[model samples]
Each structure stands twice: as C-alpha cells, then as structure tokens.
Target: MKHLLSTHDLDVPTVAAIMNVADHMSEINARSVPKVPALLGRTVASVFFEDSTRTRVSFETAAKRLSADTMSFSASTSSVNKGESIRDTIETLSAIGVDAFVVRHASSGVPVSVTEWTDASVVNAGDGWHQHPTQALLDAYTITRELGTGNTLAGVRVAIVGDIKHSRVARSNIDLFARLGARVTLVAPGMLLPAGLAGPGITVTDALDDVLPDVEVLYMLRVQRERMDAGLLPVGGEYSARFGLDERRARMLSGDAIVMHPGPMNRGIEMVMDPAELPGSRILAQVRNGVSVRMAVLFRLLGDGQLGA
Candidate 1:
C-alpha cells in the first residue's frame, strides 16, 4: 500500500478499509467548514502532463480540506516545456520535500516511472487508457452510498457503456467492481471494445438494449474524439440512435437503475437525456464523492497509517 498505481493492487479488505475512511471524509465534507487538520504540515504535489478538469481540482481541494500544503505542475508551463525530462522534474520537486505526488499523464506508466525518481508516494490520477484508481474508488463509494450496499457490491449488476477501448475509467471500474463482488458487463460497439476483455465476473456485448433490463447501474462513457485520429463513428444519428441513453432508452432500464457518467459528457451523443434531470442519476453525486475519496487516499498515504488494512 505504499503507492496507488492501480486498482489491481488492492484486494477486498483493503478496498473496504479505504471506503470506511472515505465515509468519514464524506461526513467532513457535509460540515460547514469542511476542513480538517488530518494532514497538517504535509505537502502534496499535483503533476499533470495531460489536461484535466475534475481530477486535478478534486485532488487540490482534497489536499486543502485535509490542511495539506499543495502545489500544481502542468507540462505546458513547467520545465518540461524546456525539454527537461520527467525524472529531472520529479527529482527537483523531491529535493524540496514533496510528500506525495498526484500524477496524470498521457503516457500509460508515468506514475509508476515517477516512483523510481522520488520517495514520495505516487497516486495515479489517470494515465493513457490505463487505470484511474481514484475515479473507480469514488464511483464505488457513490454506488455503495446510493444503494446502501455497505462496502461489498455482491450481486449488483453494473453495465459500463461506450468507448471501452479509450477509457481508463472503464478499465479501472471493471477491475474494482469485480473485486468488490459485482457482475460487470461492458456494452460497446465492436470497434470500441478491445479484444480479450471478457472473463470470469465480466461480460461484453455490443447491444445495450439486451443488458438494460437487468442492470442496476448504467455507467456511460464519453466518446474520446481526441484520442482517435480517423473517424470511428458512423454518419449522423446512427450511433446515438443505437447506443445513446436517450429518453426512450432510459425508460427501458430497471426502475431503480442509476445513470452515471464521469464528466464532460457529450450532450446528444453518449447521453441524450439531461443527466441533471434524470430521476436516478448519480452524476453529481460522483463528483462530490471524488473529493471524499481523494481525501481518504491522501490520509492513508500521508497521514496516520491506522487506516490501512
């Protein structure tokens, strides 16, 4: 538990322990001041080689809420623009006493590479089509909170829809959900899902309608147009008409099923119906849980070691 490189590194008891700590963090978030002295005098550095909105801000806010000193590093403005290597940049920060690094990079294993250069604990925010551990943690926390499932997701059916080939969130969720005892079905077009993803506790399908009736959680992923160079989509409304969670398709889901999207959702593409208006949507709940889950992670890595399983 020295570093959080991937969800695959965590087991059931460990996940439950982290979720219990996050439950406390969630309570702190509900308070008027919403600040704690748990991480006083510790410093957290957010080094993002890729552009991000929700993750970067969430980590910074989590650090602040725990009273930890925080600094931000972006590739565009840093010495990276001057051709300084990532090792050099991290070594320089390490020399100044950074306690932990929350790293997001376009490269897959940048966070793991960073651990070789510094003694600071590394938390992977998001890597290129790799694991986004914190996002999956928050998602699991949100589901548990909304469904009253405690920390175990046994017998809960979750369907992750769209863009599986390019989504780090989907990868992390599949691992975390399966570990927490949930049955996961990946719903995407043939071109979107990578080969060799189906196995025990997991299934894949191109037809969303076939799985909608039984799924308790419908997690929609955005189409990563930036990641694809050529056109992977068909012309006009064909993709949406088949795959999008429009009002008509929304009605086909189980009555208590919840709709979830990570962020920056495409209005008419992946999600046609307004997520804010959806009755069982946990989109905003996921955002709030992001702060709590990150706080728990920081506390575990940098605070007292009591929370570790």
Candidate 2:
C-alpha cells in the first residue's frame, strides 16, 4: 500500500504485517533510551487542521523515537490562517523534502486530497467522521496482546459503545475487527448509529446493559456533542444514564474482560466512573501502544517497508 488512508483499504495480511512491525517498535519503546536509527535523515511532517493532544504528540514522539525529523503544523498559526489553501501548505512542505506526512483534518478525504499535492507518502491520522486508522491499529494491538491469541482478533466479542454516527474510530474499528475475525456489536442510541450500517460478523444494539456481559472488549467512544443534531441528545444526562460505563454497568463485565476508550473523553457522559476503578481497563495501555503503532506505520511507509530489515 502506498498510503494508509483507511482500514477499508487493508486486508488481513497487511494488518498482520503492520502489527508485527509494531511488535518490533514496542520493544524499542520499552528500552531505556527508546531510540532507533531506522528512520535517520528522513522527515515526517504533521499537518493537522484540527486540534489534538494525544494523536499529534504521539505521532511526533513516534517519529522522534525512530530518529526521523519531524515538522509540526498547526492550522491556527500557519499560513492557513492567512488564507493559504491546504494545497499550498502541503506543496510548500513537500518542496522542503518531507518524506512523509501525518495528516489530520476535520474534513473527510483531506489526506487523500493531500496526496495530489505532495510526493510524500501520506498517513491519515483522523479525518472527519470517516476514519482513524492508527487508533484502530493500536486498539487491535492492545486487544491481541491482552488475549495472547496472536495477531488475529478472531472470535473476540467487541462492543464499541457511544457516538457511532460521528466516530471515525468506531467506523475504522468495525471494519478492522470484522477483518480479523472478531464479532463486533455497536452499542449506542439508535440515531447515534449510521443508517443501514451492516456487515458480516457485525451486530448493532441500543441496549448497552444487554450487550455488556457477553462482550470481551467493551470499547467506549467519546460522545461528539459537536457533531450531533439538536434533538439527538438533550442535556446529555439521558444518554449518560443509559449508555455511560458507570461502576454498576462495569460490574456486568465478566472477569478477564477489558474496558477501552479512545481519548479526550467525555468523562461524565461517556464514562460516569474513573477508569482506574475498572479492573481490566486498557485506556492507558492504548495510549502507550499508540506510539509504537505509529512508529510501525512510519517505518512501513517511509523506510524500506520491512520488519527488522
């Protein structure tokens, strides 16, 4: 694959290959120095049109860990604020010899469009409510690590909860989990789910409590209040009441089950209780693994595209 645009573009072997590379990256991250010369002299630029803390910092750290040079871009402070187009910004950076770009935009397909303006390989960090490939990668890695079931998530019961209609993470995970042979159930209010969302090995439900006991991975999603229509959630209290992962609902999870959440969370709304109290919570693990997953992606795209080569 020339570009990491969406999970829809990946098959099983490609996913496994990337995750194997992540295993190598994860080892590097565990070392005292946590540094490598794999990507020395190569430049990876982060061009983000949206605000982010985890993804932006995570990608920068990943590139640095591999000894790749990183360029940071913020739309608010860049020429974008001065009316320069995205094409101009990307072209400008490409002219300076960027080897790869980690692009995140509030608009869907921005990364795909960026490919036209630059010769560098492009990785979609997150775009609109379309896809967040790297997040899904880390999540799958964390799950597979926990299960000790090797690379595939086959037969794993994963319930992705909350704001499905507006979650790029949810969309990416559903495709990936299904590809890896996992059973995925989307838990949300009816309107939160996309209309006619269906696929093999996929399930949908509005009842979180009913889905809780059965799923091995209970993934909580941030409720995107900004993306919702007015009536979908009034006051946010009701949604929390029904779908939030409170202590009581968390107890429904079986022993050895795990809880996950993609970050910058809506604490009171998406999760009524602190994740610290949850026995098998993988939220911090997800963040820790994110850097390694991103490092693997950068290696695959910008380096020789081989593991341990």
Candidate 3:
C-alpha cells in the first residue's frame, strides 16, 4: 500500500495481508531481543502538528523494532513556531531524506494534502475527527487474538460507545469492523452522533443498557471535551449516569466479552469504574499490540514486496 490514509476503500485481501504480517511481527515482539533488520536502511519521520503521547511513541517504536532509522518533528517546538507552513516543513524533511511520514494533525485530510508535497510514503497517524487507521488495525488484532477469530470477524458483534461525532478512532473502527463482516452497533447520545451514521451491517442507538448484553466487543470512547464547544450534554454526572460503563454494565457482559477504550480516557466520565478490575478488559493488550500492527504497516509500505509472496 502506498499510503494508509483511511479504511474506507481498503480491500479484504490487503487487510488480510497486514493482519497476517502483524502475526509475524507480534512474534518478534515477544522475543528476548525484539529487533529486526527488515527496514535497516529506511528512515521514517513522525511529524505531529498536534500533541500526543501514545500514537507518536507507538509509531517510532514500531519503526525501531524493524530497525528503521527515525526522526520526529514537533510543531510546538519546531520552525512552525516561526510560522512555517506544513508544506514547507514536509518539503524540508523530504530534502533531509525521509522514506516515510507518519503524520498527525488536528484537521481532516492533512495527510492527503501532504502527499502532494513529498515523494515519501505517507501514513495518516490521525487527522481530525476523520480516521485513525493504525489504531483500528491494532484494535482489530487485539480483538482477533482475544477471541481466537482468525483474520475475519464474521460473527462477532461490536458496539462502539460514546462521542462518535468527534472520534476519529470510532470512524475508522466502524468502517473496518463492518467491512470485515462484523455486526457493528454505535451507541451514543443523540447529539453526539453524526448524521447518516447507520446503514447495512451497522446499528445505532441511544440506549446503552439495551445493547450491553448482546455485544461481544464493547469499545468505549471519551467525551473529547477538548474538541467540544460547551453544552453538548446537560451535565457530566447525567452523561455518566446515562452512558458510562460502570460496574453494573460491566457485569452485563458475558465472560468472553472484551471492553476497550483508546487511550487518554476520561476516568470518571466515560469509564465510571477502573478497567483494571474488569476481567474482560483488553485495554493494555491494545497498547501492546499497537507496535506489532504498526510494524506490519510500515513494512507493507516501505519493505520489498515479499510478504505473502
């Protein structure tokens, strides 16, 4: 794949290839020395136009695991402080010899525009409330490993809860899971949901309790107050009361059900209880699998095409 911009048009064969390669990368991660020479001569640059902790570090770690040289550009500390444009910054980095760019920005479609400015391969780390492809990738891998469901999620039932209007992860996951044959249900408050979100193989609801018992994968999302303008919900306590996954809802899940939340969780709001206390939690597994899945992505874009050859 030249660029992993979104999961919208990603084909099943390509998804299978990435998932299949991630299995090999996951094994490498479990080794005593989790390092490989697969990408020795390649250099990857992570350019984030916004703040991050997990996504930025995860991509760099993935690059390192494959022995790819890495560079990072922080907009806060870089020439961006001097009013440098994204195109200019990317052109500058390209001139410095980058083989790939893992880009994150606060606006949608930044990565797509970035492709016009450089010859290097581009992977959208994240762009606004649009998509976060690798996050969906790792979450898929984690769910597969957790459920022992090969590469496809044919019979699995997944419910994505909370802040769908502002969640890039939810957007990508909804596209990916449904395309992989999983039945998806999006649960959220009325105002939090974007228009035209429901269709074939997808369900939408404002009642969280009604779907709790039947969902096999309960994916939670934070309220994203940083992206909100005031007054979406009446009060924080009311939101927690209506949609939060507290101990009661946790008990509604079956023994095999897995609860997931992409990082930077709003502790008392979206998640009313500690995830550590829940036996079905795969939160840490998602974080652990991120490196291997991302390694698979980088290898697919930058490595010689021998994967599944």
Candidate 4:
C-alpha cells in the first residue's frame, strides 16, 4: 500500500481496511466543521497533465479536510509547457518537501514512473485508459453504503455498461469488484470491448437486456467521444436506443438494483434517465464518498497506519 497505482495491487483485506477507514472519514465529514488535524503540517501536491474537474477538486478538498497544505500543478501553466521532462518536474516538486502527489497524466504509467522520481507517495488520479484507483474505491464505498452490504461484495452482481475500450473507471471497477468477491459483467458492443477481458469472476456481453434482470448494480459509462476519432456507431440515437439507460431500460432493473454513472454524463446518449432523479441512483453518493475515500488513502499513505488498525 506504499503507492496506489492500481486496484490490482490491492487484496481483499487491504480493500476492507481502506473502506473501514473511509467509514470513519465519512463520519468526520458529517461534522459541522468537517475538518480534522490528522494530516496537519503535511503537504499534498496535485499534478494533473490532463483536463479534470471532479478528481482534481475532490483530492484538493480531501487534503483540505484532513488539514493538509495543498498546491496544484496544471501542465498548461507549468514548466511542462516549456518542455520540461516529467522526471525533472517531479524532482523539483520533491525538493519542495511534498509528502504525496495526486497525479493525473494523459500517458499510462506516469504516476508509477513518478514514484521513482520522488520520495513522495503517489496516488494515481488517472492515466491513459489505465486505472483510476481512487474512483473505484469511492465507487465501491458508495455501493457498500447505499446497499448496506458492509465492506464485502460477495455474491453481488455488477454490470458495467458502455465504452469499456476507453474507460479507465471500468477497468479499475472490474478489478476492485472481482477482488471484493463480486461478479462483474462487462456489457458493451464487441468493438468497444477489449480482448481477453472475460475470465474467472468476470463475464463479457453485448446484450444489455439479458444481463439487466439479474445485476444488482448497473454502472453506466459515458461515451468517450474524445477517444473516438471516427464514428464507432452509425448514430448516437441508435446507440442510445440500444445501450443507453433510458426510462424504459431503467424499469428492466431488478428490485432494489442501484444505478451508477461516473459522470459528465451524456444527457441523451449514455444516460437518458436523469441520474439525479433516478430512485436508486448512486451518482451523487459517489461524489460525496470520494472525499472520504481519498482522505482515508492520504491518511493511510502519509499518516500513521492506526486509523483502520
């Protein structure tokens, strides 16, 4: 647990430990001040090479909540624009006595590479079609909270729908859910799915209707239009009609089944049913849980390991 590069690096006990710490972190967030001295005097640096809204702000908020000093680095304004190398930039940040780096890069493995350049622990915010470990952590936390399933996901069936080829969230979720004892079904068109994704605790399919009735969690992904240069489908409507979680498809869900989306949602494309209005939607819950999960991660990596012990 020195660095959170991917969910694949975590086993069941470790995941449960993080979730337990996150439970306490969530309680702290519910207090009037919502601030703690757990990480006081520590400094966290957020370095994002790619565009972000939720993750960047969430990490900054998490750091602040734990009373950690924070600084932000955007590639557009940093020495990166002047062609400074990644290693050099990290070395410079390390010189400033940063305790941890919450890094998001357009290239896969940049965060892992950053670990070698600095003594600071690295939390991967995201990387190119790779893993978003924190996102998956928060998502799992959200599901456990809402479903009252505690920290274990045994026998829970989860279906991740759409854009599997380009979604780092999907990749991380599949790994996390499997490790936590959940059955994961990746639902996407054949062209959108990666090769060799189906085995063991995982399944793959293109037909959403067949899987909808049995799954307890329906996780929808936004169509990554930025990743799709050429048209992956004939038209948006056709895709939406077939794959999108519209009102009609929403009804197909099993009783007590929850809906989820890692957002910047496509209103009429990947999600026609308003996530906010959906009865069982955990979309906003995921956002709120993100702060707590990240706080737990920071505390685990930077603070004494007594929180969940």
Once fitted onto the true fold, the runs of candidate 3 whose alpha carbons sit more than 4 angstroms away are 227-229, 305-309
Question: Can you tell me which runs of candidate 4 are displaced by over 4 Å?
Answer: 305-309
RMSD of each: 1.4, 1.7, 1.6, 1.6
lDDT by residue (tens digit), candidate 2, 1-309: 678889986788888888898999989999999999999999999999999878999999999999999999999889899999999999999999899999999999999999899888899999999999999999999999988879899899999988888889999998898999999999887877898678889988889999888889999998777654566653477888888989999889999899999897788988899888889899999998999999998998888643222
| Model 4 C-alpha lDDT per residue in residues 1-309, reported as the tens digit of each score | 578899886777778888998999999999999999999999999999998978999999999999999989999889999999988888998898899999999899999999889888889999999999999999988888888889988888999999888889998998888888889999888888988677678988889999999999999998876544477753687888778998878888887999988887889889987776678788888888999999999999899633233
Give the alpha carbon lDDT tens digit for every residue of 1-309 in model 3: 488889874677777888889999989999999999999989999999999979999999999999999999999989999999999999999999999999999999999999999989899999999999999889888888899998888879999998898889999998888888899999988888899777779989989999999999999987776544477754677888988999999999988899999988888888999999999999989998999899998998899533232
Error of 1 at 243 (Å): 1.4
Off by over 4 Å in 2: 305-309
Question: Each candidate: what lDDT?
Answer: 0.89, 0.89, 0.89, 0.88
Each candidate structure's TM-score, on Cα atoms with residue i matched to residue i, is: 0.97, 0.97, 0.97, 0.96
Clashes of 1: 0
- Candidate 4 matches the true fold with a TM-score of 0.96
Off by over 4 Å in 1: 227-229, 305-307
Residue 138, candidate 3: C-alpha displacement in angstroms? 1.1
